[model samples]
Target: MARTARGFAALALAVALFGSSGCGYNTLVSEREAVESAWGEVQNQLQRRNDLVPNLVETVRGFAAQEENVLREVTEARSRVGGAATPSEAIEASNQLSNALSRLLVVVERYPELRSNQNFLRLQDELAGTENRLGVARKRYNDAVQRYNTTARRFPTNLVARVFGFEARDYFEAPESARGVPQVDFQRRP
Candidate 1:
């Protein structure tokens, strides 16, 4: 009878251990979901920016026919953003595009006539709003990544994360070239 009781106790302990591990798995899954949702927001904001680019380019082109350099830069940046494969790469490309667009807008400022144009102003306002949204999305994504990474690295959750192959996510950092406001040369020949 003592031997049978000892076997039952061992079985109970095993079940308790399994139950504890299951809780850890649940926490890991929840944290990963949070990260994924945040990433989705980031992607949405990027798509918004991409969608706004063509309209912005056309508006700029309508008033500033001689601004070939600015147009080309914006086009190149847009192409880079479209070709980006990873989240990190997309952020970098987006930053590049933002810088290029900023330079182009500064050029537009020189043409007071262009600035007064209703269509150009509307596109500029929309782009500005999209930039703000993108910034918020990136911050949210970073916060979620931090939470997931912290949970995944914690003692009990670490074991489950390892088992489930959860890896650390990269932060959305602006590109080095876009560290500051891009210099805009608006020197048109007199």
Candidate 2:
């Protein structure tokens, strides 16, 4: 048999073996839901971080008004996160926000009083907690994506996935450029 014909034969065998039990279709449904649920958790954590930003910005602003450029970058990045229409866009925006926030923190290092301020300390603590949660959520989301994508793309399941219009989901990954450690010059003035 030709390669294409053998491939069809395998698919036919897979469907014939699993089709009557409905396991393939049901597994796809369950996995897709798991992925969606994981994605929602990621969004929830992202929102928690988002809600904390303005307070962080304000507290930093009070003591470091001169640091307008870094502050603006953080705000703009947060706005992009809010306005992102897709998972890929949100991932990119969220990465930007992370970078911008890192720059903002570097600015904080320059001012001794800002570091000691109670409000800034509290906000910083809260932001740390939110980042931890966001990290956990992202891990879960990626794990769920792995499971769903595996199921959707696997042998017989691929047939069912195609039949039911279940397409592969995009993973929330940092862009290659963003993956590198950000170069910060401690000597540079904010």
Candidate 3:
């Protein structure tokens, strides 16, 4: 009878251990998935912005072909963003694209007719909306990363994360140059 009782106790201990580990493992998996979903959203928004670029460029080009430097910069920046292999690289390339787009907008301002063009106006509005979406996605992604990183670094769960090779993700940070309020001069030339 004592031997049978000892066997049952061993079984209960084993079950408890397995159940505890399973819970922690599942939580880690859930948090990791949240981070991935957020990252996917950020990428989706970025892609949407990228898809709108060509239309924007074409519309502006029809009205401001002489703005070759700005156009080339925007094109090259877009290419970099498209080919980026990592989050950090993507962020850097995104900043370059943003700066190029800003320059393109400034050039458009110089040509008042471009601003009045129907297609240009439409594309500009679409791009602005896409940019807003990207901002929201980026915020969501950062929030997810913060949660995952914090939980992954905490006690007990960190052990499971380490065992499962779940590493923390990098946050999308805007470049220092792009962090300031954009300057816009509204004075018309005489």
Per-prediction count of colliding residue pairs? 0, 0, 0
Q: Is candidate 1 or candidate 3 better by TM-score?
A: 3
Deviation from native of the Cα of residue 80 in model 3, angstroms = 1.6
Top TM-score hit = 2
Clashing residue pairs in candidate 2 are: none
Native-referenced Cα lDDT, model 3: 0.84
| Cα error, candidate 3, residue 72 (Å) | 0.8
Alpha-carbon shift of residue 92 in model 2 (angstroms): 0.9
Give all TM-scores, in the order shown: 0.81, 0.85, 0.84
lDDT, candidate 3, 66-180, per-residue tens = 8888898998899998999888888888889999998887787787777778888788889889999999999999999898888788766677778889898899888887889
Models ranked on lDDT: 2, 3, 1
Q: Is candidate 2 or candidate 3 better by lDDT?
A: 2
> Judged by lDDT, which candidate is best?
2
RMSD each, Å: 4.4, 4.8, 4.4
lDDT of 2 by residue, 45-99 (tens): 8899999999999999999999999999999999999999888898989999998
